[model samples]
Target: MTSLAEATGHALDLLLAGDAGLWQIIAISFKVSGSAILLATPPALLTAFVLAYLRFPGRRLLISLFSTLLSVPAVVVGLTLYLLLSNQGPLGDWRLLFTQSAMVMGQVVLAFPILVAMGHAALQSVDKRAWETARTLGASLLRAFFMVLREARFGLLAALLAAYGRIIAEVGASMMLGGNILDYTRNIPTAIALETSKGEFAQGIALGAILLLLAFTLNGILQHVQGKGVPST
Candidate 1:
């Protein structure tokens, strides 16, 4: 108990003192995860819309694939991405491996299925009459689509928030593709892993605390957005 208390005190000191490395890791984490979510949102939204409204061949298969992917292990994603970005792989010439972009790419892939699935649910929950009413009022197909989207805005926002939560908390893909390089690709999860392994429990605890705070802040924002009826950007 004494050792635990001492460790807690040390962790608090590190956090209060504003360690530079910790801040760098936090920044990198936000940058990679934020960028991944942003880049993924458009396609996810479009795919969800199609899945919810359009009836075509293989739609069920596509939905099934995404559902399966939602349960996919993070390590599998990391290994798959690593192989694709390795020297002998198709994308090897790009030299993207071990970079922030690589980490973002992996996260984007990881988050895509969740975004698509949830977004589809949100869109499907909208009233069909809403779309018909807009169409009857002479709204173009695009305008009617937007109207349906507006009604489902809250659910869509939920999807975005969920995707953000997943990407930010994930460690495997980021570590594998980014190489967890200090001051570069290192993020909260990767930093926590590396620090704990090295017996730097104080820094690890501090990062873990920050990560928990981030999760809380995100959930708060999600609730606010849902209450405000704001359209996800």
Candidate 2:
């Protein structure tokens, strides 16, 4: 109990002191994950819109594929990317392994399906007449699409928040692709893993606290949005 108390105190000190290492890890985490989700949003949302609005053969199969990918383990993604980026791999010439870019790529893979699946759900839940109403008003195709998006904004925001939560908390892909390089590709999850391995309880606890805070804050806002009458599910 005494040791636990000491560790907690030390962890608080690390946070309160604004320890550079801790902050750097946090910053890199947000940087990579944020960029990844931002890059993925457009295509994912477009794909969702298409899937939700268009009728086509094999569409259900494709939707199922995206849903299945949502549960794929992070290490599996990391391993696949590792091979693709390795020296003998086809894309090896670009030499992107063990870098922040690689980490971001892994996160993109992680977040894409989530955004697509949830976005599709959001768009599909909207009243079909919304699209028709916009088009009947002689709105251009682009404007009609924007109208549908506006109607689904709350649910869309929920989807994005969920995606951000997943990528931010993931450890396997980040550790494998980022290489946990200090002052470089290291991120919150990877840094926490490293610190715990080294028996640095204070640093690990500090990082964990930050993660908990982020998770709580995100979930709080999510609940608030849902309470404010977003789409159910």
Candidate 3:
């Protein structure tokens, strides 16, 4: 108990003292995950828009496919990318393996499906009349697109937060693709794994605390957004 207490105190000190190594890990985490989510969002949301509004053939299959992807393990994604980016693989010429770019790619894959599936759900919540009325008013398709998006903004924000939450903390994809190189591709989850494996419980505790605080803050914002513009009972 005394040792645990000591480790906890040290963890708090590291977090409070602005530890450079720790902050660097945190920065890498945000950089990779942020890039992944941003790059993935527009495409994912566009695809979701299509799936939600279009009635083309095989649409149901596509929706089901994305929904299924939501359940795929992160390790599977990491392995697949690892194979593709490895020497002798199709994309080996790019030589992206064991790099932050590869980590971003892995995370983009991990976040894409969640954004698509959840974005589709969010778009589905909008009243079809909103689209019809906008068109009826002679609003250009682009304008109507923004209008529908406006209606679904809160839910879309929720999806964004959820996707960010997932990729930010995912260890497998980052670990396999990044090799967890310190001061390079190292990130929060991978760093925590390293610290814990080495029995350096303090840093791991600090990083874990960050993840918990992040999750709580995100949930709080989501709840607030969801409640906005709604009549209070």
Candidate 4:
């Protein structure tokens, strides 16, 4: 108990002191995770809209593929991307391996499936009459899309939040692709891993506390959004 109390005290001190390395890790985490979420949003929204509105062959297969990918292990994503970005690989010339970009790419892939699946469901749940009413009123397809999006806004927000949560908390892809480099690719999860391994429990605990707080805050906001009102187009 004494050891645990001492460790907790030390971790709190590190956090309260705002350790420089800790701040760097936090910044890198936000940078890479935020970038991944931003990049994933448009395509995810588009794909969701398409799947919700369009009738075509192979749509089921595509949706199923995304659903399957959602369960794909992060390490697998890292391994696949690593091969693609590594020297002597097809994208080797870019020399993007072990960089922030590499981490972003891996995180993008990791988050894409969840965004697509959830966004699609959200769009699909939008009242079909909304689209019909918009078209009957002579709204352009783009306008109709915006209308539908408004109706599904809450669900869409949920999807985005979920994707952000996944990418921010992921370690496998970040470590494998970012190489967990200090002050660069190192994020909360990866830093926690490295620090724990090195017996730097204070840093690890501090980061863990930060990550938990972030997750709680995000989830609370999402719940508030969902609870406030239903989306109306």
Candidate 5:
């Protein structure tokens, strides 16, 4: 217990002293996950919208496939991407392995299915009349689509938060794809893993503190969004 308390104190000191390496790790985490989520969101949302609203052959199969992907292990994604980006791989000429971009790619694979599945559920729960009402008002198909999205905004936001949470917390994909290189591709999760392994508990605890704070902030925003979404009594 004394050792734990001392470690916690050291963690606080690290944060208070503004450790540059720690902050750099945090920044890399956000940069990679942010880029992955941003790049994946539009297409994921579009696919969700289609699955929720459109009728087509094998659509159910596609939805099932995406839903299955939601549970895939992070290391599996990293391995598959690693293979594709390795020197002998077909697309290896781009030389993206063991880089931040590779980490982003792995995260994109992880987040895309999550966004699609959650976004589909959200869009499906929304009233069908939203699209119809917009069309009744002579809104273009694009405008009607926007109307549906507006109605599903809260749920979509929830999906976004969930995706961010997953990617930010994931370690295997980032570690394998980014190689956990110092001052470059190192991120919070991988850094925590490395630091803890080296008996450097303070930095790991500090990074964990930041992650906890971020989780709290996201939950707060989710609650606020939910409150605003609810109809007044």
Candidate 6:
């Protein structure tokens, strides 16, 4: 067995040498998670907008449902989707199981609630007068909507980054949906899980390092964005 220090050194060497296999796993993670976030974003923003600004029947119920979803475990999500996509399931004809699309679907489900919840909180923080003033100035409904969004931009951006961070690091959904296939759907988290399980600590540690760095970077960016929201004294 390789010593921990030796494995650490080798991991750094693999990273510095730009190992193709490692980068491929990273790329697949970006591709799947990126696609999921993009697909999830528009609807999340619209839903958050409605939840924050519109007074409708059962609105509170909807908000509570989304908040509840935020706490659901990732593996449970993976299991539910697994059954839905399995051959015995209704949607199985689409043959999406163990594919990147399946991974994207799982991630979209995981990300949507976070985006909606956080985006709603952000939009809710804006002064209602911002929306009214835009309309009072003779702006079209769509125009006024955008004006409100601009006022809440920093918060929305933070929500987006936070959602991205969650999906990118999650292993359960990707493992079940993507199958951790080499040179294919294997992503950072799934790859790390596999490597660690197989006693390939060097690769696991290297990938773990990447995720840590990514997390720090996202946190820094979130702080910066929130800072921009504050009035300069």
Clashing residue pairs, backbone N/CA/C < 3 A, model 3: none
lDDT of each: 0.89, 0.91, 0.94, 0.91, 0.94, 0.92
Candidate 2 minimal-lDDT segment of 10 residues: 224-233
Question: TM-scores, in order shown?
Answer: 0.92, 0.96, 0.96, 0.96, 0.96, 0.97
* Native-to-model Cα distance after best TM-score fit, residue 169 in candidate 5, in Å: 0.6
Candidate 6 or 4, higher TM-score:
6
Off by over 4 Å in 6: none
lDDT per residue as tens, model 1, 42-116:
899889999998999999999999888898877789899899999999999999999999999999998999999
Q: Which structure is stronger by TM-score: 2 or 3?
A: 3
Residue 165 deviation, candidate 4, in Å? 0.5
Tell me the deviation in Å of residue 162 in model 1.
Answer: 1.0
TM-score of 6: 0.97
lDDT of 3 by residue, 31-100 (tens): 9999999999999999999999999999999999999999899999999999999997899999999999
**Candidate 5 residues 1-233, lDDT tens each?**
23778988999998999889888999999999999999999999999999999999999999999999999999999989998999988879999998999999999999999999999999999888888889999999988988889889999999999999999999999999999999999999999999899888888899999999999999999999999986512
Which segments of candidate 3 are over 4 A away from where they belong?
231-233
| Residue 196, candidate 4: C-alpha displacement in angstroms | 0.9
TM-score of 3: 0.96
**How far is 206's C-alpha from truth in model 3 (Å)?**
0.5
Q: Number of backbone collisions per candidate, in order?
A: 0, 0, 0, 0, 0, 0
Worst 10 residues of 6 by lDDT: 224-233
